[model samples]
Target: MSGTSVLALRLAGPLQSWGASSRFTRRTTESAPTKSGVIGLLAAAAGIERGDDARLAPLAALRFGVRIDQPGTRIRDFHTAHHAVTGASMPLSERFYLADAVFLAAVEGDHTLLTGLRDALRAPVYAPYLGRRSCPPAGRVDLGLHEGARLHDVLQSMPWQASAWYRRGNRSPQALTVLREAGPGESVQTADVQRDQPVSFNAAHRRHALRTVVTLPVIPGLAAAGGSRDMHDPYAALDAFDAVEALEDERP
Candidate 1:
């Protein structure tokens, strides 16, 4: 595509569930939002019906990436239901969700499509949810459009969307983690592979493909450290105290 633009989305919610390998009895969630979940959100914004393959194809082809600003804790719930036809009780089912998480998602595509998507999200035809209908977005879903930006650039430039408490706990104000979809034949240094790409959303013949996602560390508004130090090291606190004392001693 020529002159691509990225439509940025802030997917912060109380309960977000992006299921990857869910079965009948247990519904699990991926640590990060899946490609299928994101595309489905776009489709909803565009008013595409469930089985509308023609309208869904373009959205599915977009390059998707997600930055996990805050990797929320996983919470599970036990639920039981009764059969509709009979009075038989169904087995207990375990549902998983990420509580109080914030993700920055980028969908890079043509400028026209990106602008259209931004507008649609602002006043979506169908109400958008954080994966499941029960889990709705907690904040403004659209973060506006980034013109002529690639996936990596968008991830790096987007501001941190973590909660105030989470940001306060961070060692550095600029700390952030990015998870981008790897390009073709690109060597992935550290990544987790997931099979969540949607080939067909048809219930009768659902299909997906494998996608490689690389995790990257981004430090905005700060220079890179000379060397890495463990934030959780007990000695680090002592070292900081020593440094403060040395500075105090040097002061006039």
Candidate 2:
């Protein structure tokens, strides 16, 4: 309750990876974007270099929530490299990613800070990637800065950012799912604790703490479908041909 502003970001990309528990030989991605990754992106936009713990602290403190408009398919790639020390072949590694994913992320904090972040995203100091350097954002990243908004409110209010194809296929156009980082004193029935709280970004002393997150079901008040009409029956012609053939067979 320090301030009433939330910075919204559109995290849509061709390929994105938000690693939660990556090991030496395996880099896995979470099904949805992680707070660690999104905070890192904000830090980058604000021109905070890696390992700058002092500057990252405030950004990491902001409340985070994500709306999974499109939880794109998971994809993996195999990689092999030589060890730097021994010059020997290293163990094959598998890197995971989400393809054609779209997410609406919100960071609720002080009005001044959130406004600054929105401006920084519009004209970033360093190019911000989705989660890794190689996976760049496909569309505009800055959604806008909303004053008098809270974490849950922003997540629920933001319009759905699903892909055109995905939206067209939806049976109900007036629904979207939101997953939020549980805050203090919130009545959470079920929540998953994730170790994504950033302590220090120092490579040698990097650390994280556990954070509680809960999933909220679809919120109402979505805009009506637009000009893009849903596709007609996919098997209409085939079904008609099959009926004609059945009728001819019965005539014999």
- Model 2 ranges with Cα > 4 A deviation: 83-88, 171-174, 224-252
**All candidates' lDDT scores?**
0.80, 0.80
Per residue, candidate 2 scores C-alpha lDDT tens digits across 157-201 of 666666656665774445666778887688888888988878777
> Under the 3 Å rule for N, CA and C atoms, how many clashes does model 2 have?
0
Clashing pairs in 2: none
- For model 1, residues 1-252, the per-residue Cα lDDT tens digits are 557888888787789999977989999999889999999888898898887788888888888988887799999999899999997999999999999887888988888988888899988999999898989887678888888888788777666666655555774455577777876577877788888887777778777888777887775433322122112233557878999999999999
Q: Name the runs in model 1 displaced over 4 angstroms.
A: 171-174, 184-191, 221-252
Which pairs of residues collide in model 1? Answer: none
Backbone atom clashes (below 3 Å) for every candidate = 0, 0
**lDDT, residue 190, candidate 2:** 89
